[model samples]
Target: MGIFKKPPLRGGKRNAGVPDDLWTKCQCGELIHTLDLKQHAYVCAHCNHHFLLPGRDRIELLTDAGSFEEMDHGLYSANPLGFANYERKTADLREKTGLNDAVISGRATIDSFPVTLAVMDFKYFAGSMGSVVGEKITRAIETATREKRAVIIVSASSGARMQEGMLSLMQMAKTCGALSRHQEAALPYISILTHPTTGGVTASFATIGDINLAEPGCMIGFAGPRVIKETTHQDLPKGFQTAEFMVEHGLVDAIVDRTKMRTKLAELLSYLMPQPSLSGQETLG
Candidate 1:
């Protein structure tokens, strides 16, 4: 019998589709190695411009190793509106992004301070809030309320999913209601807004957190600048709706750098949930 040999990859590389080396260009016209970018939490090292961080990566960055227990992994979109190509588009997005929906909700600990966490992945349909996404977030908040844990949501969305129509719009109300109950329980809720947190999302739970922190230079508003400009027909002020502008106007509590996000979050969590003493007594402050 003759020995068989496997065919070489089409691109003459072991990993055909994957590039061995990657370089990212910053908006400031600087190029940096991708590994270095990851080291800096995807922020531009030179200009300090914040880049889009994946939801999974964000969770890993903030939580202790092996501390995240995902809550609603099986919940998925069902094409409730029966819109054109809605099912196919959703299926394609699932295969492309490896996400059940835009939002991933779960239980996580920041420096051992337990909290209910939900992160929106923009790669999945612009991180739009659909029925499933809204349901998962609402459930996460409810879970936090029942467990007496803090709730932290990292939002990076363009708005409600248009394909789901009013179904998606209603999620705004549902999530807000859940957060209201969580608030009444006296539990801390932190909302972190990344670039492009807009539309119905801004109108609802995104702005209702006890502490709202936004990434540097992020665009956050109910509508885009062009839409507002056209509607109001007024010359908008410079830096309007940007994170810095919002912070200046007292809209956002602070603008956090991506590199120090984990440290800042851990610090906040520690302040919100002080550790018990060796004698097992927590001092109520």
Candidate 2:
């Protein structure tokens, strides 16, 4: 047989795509280096579009260094509805995202304040709120209640996982129920809404936070604009179902930037949660 060689990649030196491990485009047509994106917390410096952030990275961004101790790390999804290839698909996602489920629940400190943190990974099946995800979140909230720690849930999801049927939908109520108890104990819960928070998540624990915060331009609603328009035969208003609009209308507490999220959370925690006294004489009152 004659010796042959494989063809070289496009552009002579690299792949043809924009973000070929080197470059990406902003919404304003600005060329951004992939390294620049990481340095900027994945926010576009030109137009400031908030990009999808990975769950583990978000945990690192929000939590104190060496402070994250993950809980329920071994839990995986089960095919309660017997969806074809669901287990196989979930296993693949587990390997791909390096997460046991869509949500990563752990005990972490933000600015040295203890918190129960749960971050959802959108790369895993759109971060669907399936059985395991629901269980993990509920357990996180319950643990926070027990520890008298603040609960911070960063929600990014497509809503209930249809593959699990009613089992998935039940999570909406289950998480909320746990949260209701958490609230009764007077603990603070800060829900961070990233891009594309909708469906049951928007209607449930995600929205009922003591202070609901969202990133700029995050899409938040029960149903997306297109789905609502198609179902109701109505024209959606400008900027409808967005974090910007929600803040203006008082649905969301504030539209926070990704860069300032930790600072804002720490500030808010200072206000909502009382810090422990440092000196013994302070109790003289």
Candidate 3:
């Protein structure tokens, strides 16, 4: 008989003095402490997997401390089509997430460069865009236009909310219309496409950025690959919907490392901002 029976350790229990919730296993099979993972901006150091950032976290990561001034609050979706149990589900999510909708729109300074920011919260119903999400984004863009500042929208969504029916689908046109005016004003509209930015959102304003940037390994597509495969009955190209793929195919402009995004945005904004015209020296037609 063994002198001591060994306790069977499984899953994260393999480590001692580490709480299960404080640690998570990455897709690359590396076990990382949550604090350390957070320190790395939730990227898997081993495989460079970019974990999705929540809307609020994204705002903090991109904007200067205390520089964000939020607008368009308390706009929640109603049961426009009266989808069964949708109101109950939305109410539950609102209570859980403390957000009235899937997107947070406001003004903030990125590296002291003024911008109107709208970050989509995937935790809220997969970051689905319904009436409120569309309205908030439209308002944000219009506000930026009036203020003569740049616009930045970080998208992390599966698609439009199904419960709202046509109302949800209509956001595609509404947001695009707002962006058209912003473009006409010569103000930059930067769209940061994150993991799983797909469906109607992709087909709309997500891909029309003046400078569209995406995170490494983000999935940007109108439909899931599986559905495309099933529909076409053809062998799919490897990693066809990834951010890298999108860049190669001209869908995305560039892929930025999550950690470097703030610096990059500042640099871009600096370059995009009109030069002072050599200290009042002016000429031209």
Which portions of model 1 show Cα errors greater than 4 Å?
1-21, 274-285
Predicted candidate 2 versus true structure: per-residue lDDT over 1-285, tens digit per residue = 334565544557464455456877777888888889989899998898988998988988898888899999998888977899999998998888888788999988777677899999899989899889999999999998988789999999999999999999999999999999999999999999998898888888889998999999989998877778999998989989899899989988998899999999889888877774465213211
Each candidate structure's TM-score, on Cα atoms with residue i matched to residue i, is 0.89, 0.90, 0.89
Error of 2 at 87 (Å): 1.3
TM-score of 1: 0.89
lDDT of 3 by residue, 1-285 (tens): 564675555665557785658978888899888888888888888998888777887888899998898998889999988799999999999999999989999988787667899999899999999999999999999988887778999999989988998999999999999999999989999999998899999999999999999999888999888899999999999989999999989989999999899999999998886543453313211
Alpha-carbon lDDT, every model: 0.88, 0.88, 0.89
Per-residue C-alpha lDDT of model 1 across residues 212-283, encoded as one tens digit per residue: 999999999998999999999999999999999999998799989977888888888778865634542233
Span of ten consecutive residues with least summed lDDT in model 3: 276-285
**Runs in model 2 lying further than 4 Å from the true structure:** 1-19, 277-285
lDDT of 1 at 101: 93
Query: TM-score: which candidate is best?
Result: 2
- Candidate 2: worst 10 consecutive residues by lDDT? 276-285
lDDT of 3 at 218: 85
Instruction: Please give the RMSD of candidate 3 to the true structure.
Output: 5.4
Worst 10 residues of 1 by lDDT: 276-285
Candidate 3 structure, TM-score to reference:
0.89
